[model samples]
Target: MGLEKFGKCLSMAAWMSLLVVYAYAEGSSRKWRNEVLKQVNSKGPYIGLITVFPPEETAFFGTGAFKPSPIHSSLDLSGRRFRIGKVHDKKVIYVRCGVGMVNAAAATQQMVDLFEIVGIIHFGIAGNINASMSIGDITIPKQFAHTGIWDWVNQNGTLDSNDTVAHLDFETYNVPKGGHNILGQIRYIHEEFFSVSGEPNIARPLFWLEVNQEWLHVATKLERMELEQCINKSLCLPKKPKLVVGLRGTTANIFVDNAAYRDFLFHSFHVASTDMESAAVVMTSVSNGIPVIVIRGLSDKAGGQSGQNAIKTFGPLAARNAAKAVLQFLKQLN
Candidate 1:
């Protein structure tokens, strides 16, 4: 064949291959949507209520408040149990997403894919990093950021000035043996999340991921909503618990119990609560275009106290408060 004809044939072959790729992508997207539609027609269009562990579950599910449908009883998938139930006369799909960022993110995405979740309401306990906040208090944060991600520099590596981002110094824990302060510094960093509208597998990096504003507006109705301040009749919080809204919440995989780290978080990020999972849940839901909100009860001060951690004694109380707040917030929704 002539050179011109050969070039034309090659071009046609490339176009055919490109068409195949696009067709596959479209088919895969449609399949996912069709699956969600089928589930909605049969079972759902329900609100997704999520918690982290058993301790958080007791306040919402251990009692009779959640009535699980016999047909959808304990539908287990991906190491999580999704209970289709009713809470305060609103249809809800309740699930415990286990612990940590990975579990939280996986369960959230799974819930969105398997159920037609209109919105997400996640309630749980978190460590207090804000000095003004107290245990058993409920915080409905306006935004969430995954502060767990870090850029660890070498002992001798240079970093940008304070004008950039706050860097954590390890010199406090070390006596300089020589140069480099004996330990490297850590710079808190942002996370990159993919959205549906963005290019495939590419999304902008964000230091703080804002939650849905309409949901935040609805959460304002929870102001002055009562919280549980007592574990029992004798043991109660020194001060009555109050509902605090519009705080900033941060998330990490590591359980926070260090005083210095807590102070850094409070001062740098202005974070009210630090937990293992909130940001993961928020990011996943937002990526899927579903509005999500978090209700966290401050259980401990992230090692701000002098003695044993307060979580053991105050966790139950905090969990109960978060559960109550979630209920009241839901009542205001519809």
Candidate 2:
């Protein structure tokens, strides 16, 4: 009886030891899967392409031969669809990031996590803030700034309002007198302030996000290439669109159709164009340490034009031109 009891105790000890080993192995496997397995499973190094709206998405898709992949995010609460394939012989993943900063950031983060993307490229239509820029003209901004963050200041430069400020101050690249006609060096102010508190109690440092120089070089080269000059016969532009590099881009949730605000943004931020999504993408990419570039085609003159809203008429044209530029850039990358 003593020997039998001893044997039973030994069997129980072995079973418990096996259970412990199995549990440890399972935990390690999960860890490895999370850290390394997805990377190995990824069909990359991919170039991520983002467009903001349906028209922009249509324009981008028209530029390349993309094959729909079975891969999709099971956790995509936004229900945004992702497509993967090739553009100019380089692997590409194309997705629509919706129409604003929140959507852009969410989609970008998902892309970075889901794929082994080497870089991100955002292309779409923007309201032209530069008076010299015409409809169909492409602007590849050197830096992106979130213009929504502002501290309401009095005429004396004191915080007039008691609003909470998220950013105490930030600096942006200043476009020169000659415009971003060349790949000029970026400049930033010493300090600028943004209010985070209604009581003017708190503020944080905000920095302008810079585009990857290597990608910027590619964009500069694209300026020399001829792009689609016409959208369609009905909406034919007076002149062929031209590409310009080194502009500053700004983003806000507001659709800046007001001429006064358009001029204000241009004068204050030295921005060539304003859009809704690029700034978010830039911030997201910066946080992830990924290289990114933004290519925008002028669809309208903000509120500078008095006759009618040009976006309704020229949006597709601008999107197509931007797409053409992006495709050319991808070709050069190959």
Candidate 3:
């Protein structure tokens, strides 16, 4: 009987110990989160600039032909390097957010949570959805949407009596109802395995974040400024690239190289450009109530004859144009 009582007491003590550990962990987590929040919100109203990778990063803020200045560096919680400096006399923090939606979203969230950023600007090369838009042309999207989220419906066994479907079959979730900008309204359908680890495979909302109107005005004005037409004498272009603003843009994980898909997205979303990161950045910005804009230079027409080859050949030129436009916009901000 004494042994039995001792065993019960030991179990209770163990349970209590576990409770203490759990409480400590919870408290530590909350404290850490609060500290991060404090740090991010305490910083000055700095602009956040994001590029997909190193080349684009080099184009925007690196020590290359368009030498800007010595950029200050810091590491975020994720160990991603952030370059802090003044662009056109305006305070800015630039980061290469890697490539694709996941990287973009994570980096954006870190920027929002760890810095007092007033707005976000994403400058990178993108595949042009608008046939009229040529390589090296800069595009400032009015809004951004996630083209990757889709709903797949099986209609193989749901045929009509006459073996012909009466209504449209296999409908896709292109644009979320009531528009994609409304938070919590847009639902995403995804395969179970495709869901991010630790995140449930539940319906997620698609966000169509709009660029700030004031920023858009500034961007529009920058169009009148002289832009670089050539990277060098040997790399001269056939025509001087122009800045096109107020067009729609979309983002997805896939690098679209199919003409049919490109045309479909262009017509369906009324978008002029497609990239792998812009929409995710926009969504994160909108969720945090910060204004954001995407400045994309066309490295290639989506599924053009040159295809992905154009990205390598004209990518640096396009990135330079984008950087020029961004600088012009920053100057206007000042």
Candidate 4:
């Protein structure tokens, strides 16, 4: 064959290869979408919402609440489904991916299927462990600890309930020796919430206090135990999982106010930060291969509100601050 004909044949082969690669990429994306959609759209109504809160009057009714009225409802938008209520934007199809691990995962699956949420910002309230972080400060956790994912993913690749809660973290920040202070990196909201006359009356006496206290205590103890075990066993093992020392708590549970308890976590877990739903969010993202960013406001201090009402006053401020940080984060991604 002439040299010119050979060059043309090679060019044709390269073009064919490019087409094949594009086809495979598109097919893989579609397959992933279908898998996620099948599980989420299996049952019930689908809608998008940005924020969620338990049905409570105190924080819900607090001043400067940007959320819609009635706290929960459904609304129609331009070619999108949205759950009306306290969300980022009624126009943007936001999914109320509920609270806690299981609910969060289920809601997220549904959100992805129905709304096809390209990116998500799990913004809400969180407790502050670092003394420097005042109320209304934002936390963008670089590392998520004590989440149990690493334990379950052994070399064998088998699902084991025997594995403990996986301690996961983000790739954004580095672990500092002698501990790192989480104050200056993220956006800080300096504001206060209004003080209500009485305590938030819970119909069911805060059962979470007891449950959280026990689990909270065990989680810290067990995390330390696991870390120590990993360190001690590291010499004998060829490959060991990475261990991080930081605080990992949720936004919803309010048991974190006890100083002694927070102090216990500080001493035991060596945690520098705290948030409610970040771990669950991280876990879901990790499971689904979705990128997740969690930024929250310091609604309540680690200790009880000295004379101020955080749940009443700071909730809205915290929410707004979190929203701002999320917006900034989204902007930077562009």
Which rank order by TM-score, best down to worst? 1, 2, 3, 4
Q: Write the per-residue lDDT of candidate 2 for residues 173-216, one digit (tens) a residue.
A: 23433323222222222223233232254434555778888889
Task: Provide the overall lDDT of each model, using Cα atoms, as 2-decimal numbers.
Answer: 0.85, 0.77, 0.74, 0.44
**How does candidate 3 fare on TM-score?**
0.72
Given candidate 1, what's the lDDT at residue 97?
93
In model 2, the runs with Cα more than 4 Å from the true position are 1-40, 69-78, 153-157, 160-204
The digit string of per-residue lDDT tens for model 1 on 121-215 reads 98899999988889999999989988878777777778765323567877655544434565688887668789886788887777787788999
Q: Which residue window of length 10 is worst by lDDT in model 2?
A: 182-191
Any residue pairs clashing in model 3, and if so which?
40-114, 40-115
Candidate 3, residue 135: the lDDT equals: 85
Residue 32 Cα positional deviation in candidate 4, in Å, after optimal superposition: 23
Name the lDDT of candidate 2. 0.77
Model with the higher lDDT, candidate 1 or 4: 1
| Worst ten in a row by lDDT for model 1 | 173-182
lDDT per residue, candidate 3, 219-246, as tens digits? 8887766656776788877887889989
Give the runs in model 4 whose Cα sits over 4 Å from its true position.
1-49, 54-92, 146-254, 304-309
For all predictions, the C-alpha RMSD in Å is 9.1, 12.0, 10.0, 22.1
Give candidate 4's TM-score: 0.45
> Number of the top candidate by lDDT?
1
Give model 1's TM-score versus the native structure.
0.84
lDDT against true structure, model 3:
0.74
Model 3: ten consecutive residues of lowest lDDT: 163-172
- Give the per-residue lDDT digits (tens) of candidate 4, residues 1-334: 9999999999999999999999999899778756644443343232233455542222323323335434234433222234433333322235444455555556665555455454455656666666655665555544454322223232223333332222222212335434443331211111111112223441221101111122222223222112111113332222221122233443322336665545544554454555545555554444444455555556666764476545555556565555554434433342
